[model samples]
Target: MKYDSLARDIIRHVGGKENVIDVVHCVTRLRFRLKDEGKADTERLKAMDGVVTVIQSGGQYQVVIGNQVAEVYDAVLEAGGFGNAVSQEEKPEQKGGLMSRLIDIVSGLFTPVLGVLAATGMIKGLTGMLAALGILSTASGTYQLLYIIGDSMFYFLPMYLGFTAAKKFKLNEFVGMTIGACLVYPSLTAIMAGEPLFKVMEGTILQSPVHLKFLGLPVLLMRYSSSVIPVIIAVYFAARLQNRIKKILPDVVKGFLTPCITLLIIVPATFLVIGPVATWMSQIVGAVTMAIYGLSPMAAGFLLGGTWQLLVMFGLHWGMAPVGLNNLVTYGYDAVTVLKSATPIVTACVVLAVALRTKDKKMKGICWPACISSLFGVSEPSIYGVTLPLKRPFIITLLCSALGGVIMGAFQTKAFMAGGMGIFSIPSYINPETGIDGSLYGYLLAIVISGGLGFILTWFFGLSPEKKEDSASSSASDIVINSPLRGRVIPLDQVEDEAFSCGVMGMGAAVIPSEGRVHAPVDGVVTALFPTLHAIGITSDEGVEILIHIGMDTVKLNGDGFKAHAAQGDRVRKGQLLVEFDMEKIKQAGYSLTTPVIISNTPAYQAVTVLAQTGDGAGTENGAKISCEDGLLCISTC
Candidate 1:
């Protein structure tokens, strides 16, 4: 509820509740499946308070809100009047290609459980660490209790996945869970462990031991506990079956009869056919992944590690998560998780180097917090705000990460369990039965070398100081955004609206207009002209984005006493008329005429300096009156 106002602002900027089809949250992001992404004001949302960044990827609009994403997500849902369940009618038509859809599906399925999954994984790793250090015996009750806390999630993973997948496939959740429970029932598991009555195709990989017969049909029994693919496949089929069966059945009995028939048919078929087929498929997936790693560990590591962050940026990393989990369940260890582990540390080091080296105070402030977040295994801030924007530092980070992956690969490092990221993940590398081992040492060495090189290389080669001539010369890249209105200047923070004053929407000065005419601040195309004629956005030829909002809450007037001089997408020169509004009318309507001129893409520049000027071009410190076309803010590219 504390974020209710922020949430309302976010929803309005994201094109309101009508634009949203579905929304969910992971550890640090609020991902929305929107009906039309173009309707969302991405730049405005990016600059909004409480948002770290905005990304449109994997067919979703993602708003990164750091660790507090869940609370914000709840706020968004409540503020938008979107209850817990999204109606089927609201589901948007699927967009994008196959890869995009796959990424969307995978993210939806796994995101719901990621927080608790990581928590339990950390507990498991801690128990392993204690046992490895001889601080606790595995036989002790304390260790046993801790192990169960950690291990139960994985042991009954199918059930948890069943519940989530059912939501995704629009099935009755209880039925999906019932299917999962049947797969791992004690009776079925007991029968699987009993002596085989017959063996089929004994010489081939398809060979199976028949533990029982159902209507003269041999049941190829296999352990379903901890398996990934079987339950999901079963649930998908169950959903399809129940839907069809319900349509023909009488309405009164449909609810009860549909579920009973669905369970009666799907559960047995899952045991006899779907379970075996899906288990084999999972094994093939794991085997193929391991075979690639086995062929040339170093090469595989270099490729995967280098592209990991890129995949993460686009949200394609979700597609890789199940593969690692499958490998852990099938082979008891995964190489994919090992190869990617060094990336966050590398990102942290790169951001740290940038923080120390940058002369820009604003850049330094952004980098320090981003570097710390990267250390905790969250790197979106570092990637989007610092390294990626700077260009060279991000490239250096990738090269360093690849080198680290090479080292890890050559040592055959393996992750025994899913755990926390960055330094917290070190315990997962500890060999359970052998205590301290080569894998742990390999992991430590990889991170150290990668992180070390990330800092050293970035500080020296990645970032260089601006040339003296470049700093002094009037280059084309340097833009001067003039005052859009003849007004008395004020600090942006003094503006009444928090969205404008908090500096989250990017830095610029506010003006209490002495005149009603608004002019183009730079030579650019009109990117946006709000229907109410109270706001305008221009993208300068030099790539500087400026937003001129006429007055506080003037939008509520709905175009009263406002006129647009130029339409959206019209090319205009600096000082050209854009809009004319009646200041007296806005004030009469109880609105503040403290208009904000913001550099919407402030992160792309080195610094945005506010200028205080007088009639004779003399500089003043406070409340200087300015004319339209006079220099307001000087943007430094260097």
Candidate 2:
């Protein structure tokens, strides 16, 4: 319900359900893979209610929806006839370069869990702060309990990564989790503790070999708790192996046998081959990262800090996930953690500047919540809703982050534990053994620099370079009612039902649906939902009342074929999915499939406008199809 209408409108405007190749939502945007971007009415979308901006970037037609994108995503799923929409990410077209495809996979895998990751990180940071302040102690039960709670997510990182990897690769999730479990099994740890029965060459990859063998080849056993790369590689192979197994297996045994054969082949392959190779590659990545930092910490820091947010915008941040995790696993701390920690705070400060500077009341309302959300380490709301829309504040925040990195690098900062971004993660910068070390002080100084710079620079120069106008004014002035069905529009007077045809109920167009669904024509609250489910009442925010009656005298069917997804008093949006029905059932029951979309208060309006059929064949029913993107009518007042 949160973004019910926005979701529906976005889906339709992006060329309806047919044009979408797939849809995914990041923190503040609905990212769509569309068959053709040209089909979308971009200007209309930009002017629509509830949309922040329509940005076409990174091979995604992204509709900015502020913080409630997940809800909108669910609504889009229902509207598009998809249930449980977040299973496998849409595979990008292979025609693209490898880099784009890689980015697609990485972004898709990481996007769903990022919120929880940040939340758990914040908890860990707070618990550390409590211990540092002496309110909690190492030996206390409360501290121990909270500590376990905070650390569980990181320790079990591989399992989460495994689930995402399997889904991304289109393999069974349980099988992927099983592979992840094997990597970190207590048995593997016990075996690794004894001695290497055999070893690889000393200095190269898999230098310290293990005694265990998988089908006779020596297995290189390594700790897999908090691992990121090994499980992903294992699942990728498992996905391919499972798909192959399905081809040869009979239908009766396919479900269980696919798992059996795939895991049998994959487990040993993972233990003997993929695990060691990927772990070794991850090690090299960590070493390369440190080597760069070793050259000049400040310069490396400046580069990463300044561009990290930019890279995040393009989903390039996932490339660094393994490197950071590897660093933490190898050295018990990481520079990348400290290098990027100040970003959210910098973003938060820039938003505060916009909130202070904007004359538009609607813009002010958007900025404050976004700024507060940024403090908790989610910056997309601030980025898309406030700063990015304004345009200038984004530049200020990046400059602040770069300066912040310089100060942090001078202290040779490192995070002793995993945590979220922002002031809440300050304790992560503190050394676990020493507590409140020079690096923690350095982090504090960096935050001060970042927040202070963002505030001052943005206060002076952050007004949008683009001409400013009240977007809400446009919303208030125009009420464009879109078609509520995929159907042929016919004048209301031609309908056989006298209640609708003779203007007894109201004046509006009637549609004989080509599809079995009903959608909202405007942004409104559901004033009524009939018990019979044959009709619905929606009162638009602009004070226009609409009654959508489905089929002629179809109430006799008594909700048999009609499935209602919305209810009375729920606010809805233009093109949002409202009800679905079996059109064939209605026709079989001797009822017409024609639906009337009536403005119930016709006398209150100055004029009502419906589109005349304007297609190649004159006066044909299917000649010009009316959809949500094309107007059903214009509600006008003199």
Candidate 3:
């Protein structure tokens, strides 16, 4: 995917690789945090191929690349070099901001594991439902075996989070994992279950409290295991401490002595001070949540349920997960019942709406698989394919889910067991001791109402636009080209060693000359010329804006070794020389020469096709003809 090159080029285009403080990607876009947004060339990038769109939103410079984003991301990485070079670490000044740092830390820790995490969550949710329905008994062998499948990942969550946090903090992950392992150790858990090790006397551990006289203070007890905030905070300090210790300790005993001291200081501090404080803080947060839930269950449910998906969209949902886990550990049940109920109901509605609305045979066939996946709580397919495309369906789904959540909250429906949401989440809501008669009915009603409402609303309001037939008579007869360069007509893709595979960049072809001089392809005025002199934009007599980009990342060179033959707003004729470049100088300077010729006004064209390929008896040209393979890119039929 040549992500490194792509990343470098993108960074250079935005400003420079150095100007970027951080880089991350969601499903379809590369999100960059730039040092200075003023240096970016957003318009030039928008005109490039494989780019769906360019957006600057929410303090993010986003480049959308559709489905092949991973490929582009890889290319960007390859070009930018590996490790902290293009990372958030480069901007220490901004790290002081709490929300920014938190977002950075959470994104780094959770983004990589989100797919597996979501899958395991759904699996656990489903298992609970089966158990509640009596389809699988808790004592059954199958239930016991499946329990491990879903529970193992979460039971060891701190271990996974430790590794990710280590990476985010730029610390040794192995060292962090070692600390995490100690916290979750069976021995520590057993010890914490027993009495305090010693009584505090004058800031020291002693056999009796009679000696407590120094500053009139008593010592503290130390305990560990199943504690969250303390271990994370301890590791953060440990990482810094380890770095400092290595520099001061003598080489002979440094290795073992350093670790021993670290453990002695960190472990006690964690247990005696950090652990208790963090635990107390968590209790406070839980208390606040309880108060909210108690005040208006319906409002709490509606707020959390309706916004759960929105939180997921921004990747902030992980922030709430620890709260849920804390509830399960402390109170044995989370008040946030809407998380489980809302996801499945919304997903089911989206799938149903997609199935009902889509008319294209190919899309209809794809919808079946998408719908099945949604049932299993994999909603990306349904979201992107069905709901997002058919906008109103998504809105309807969100509304219905919120209504259902309100209903569930009003009933004070609580899951007796801790688990995930969805149809499979039914079991978690069941009170085994009381059978399924308690609040199980409310849970069932929520799901039915939400899913039913979403489907019915979408079915009535959503309509898929019909595909238009192509006009066979409208061909590539309008394009008349004068040579952009006087070199022999060689296959555009076959131009020596090129950047694009062949000359096909997106939906057009380019002319590769023996030299780097660029002549006008048709009579037009120069509309734009980049400061780098590597790209030029010209509007032809026929109103086609042809963009000619000389090489990849050439903009970084900043106009070196190239001269513009024409100024912006200057009219040019076919074969009129535009830009002259030193090909040998550029090559020796380590820059690519594979230029891209793109039709900037692509949306206005009915269709674009490449005609340079020969099957049996067609003569090849230097460039390919651009026309529609299926039909026009855009059209108005009479």
Please say which candidate is ahead in lDDT: 1 or 2. Answer: 1
Model 2 TM:
0.50
Please identify model 3 stretches exceeding 4 Å from their true place: 1-130, 133-136, 140-142, 164-170, 179-183, 186-281, 303-403, 412-441, 451-550, 553-594, 597-638
Q: What is the lDDT of every predicted structure here? A: 0.75, 0.71, 0.58
lDDT of 3 by residue, 71-145 (tens): 677677667753432321122222235644543444335545555554554565566667767799989999887
Which 10 residues in a row give candidate 1 its minimum summed lDDT?
86-95
CA deviation > 4 Å runs, candidate 2: 1-122, 164-170, 186-201, 204-211, 221-233, 302-404, 410-442, 448-638
Against the true structure, what is each candidate's TM-score? Answer: 0.45, 0.50, 0.46
RMSD of 2: 15.0
Model 2 steric clash total: 1
Q: Which stretches of candidate 1 lie over 4 Å from their true place?
A: 1-94, 110-114, 183-192, 197-200, 205-233, 269-274, 282-444, 447-638
Top candidate on lDDT is 1
Question: In terms of TM-score, which candidate is strongest?
Answer: 2
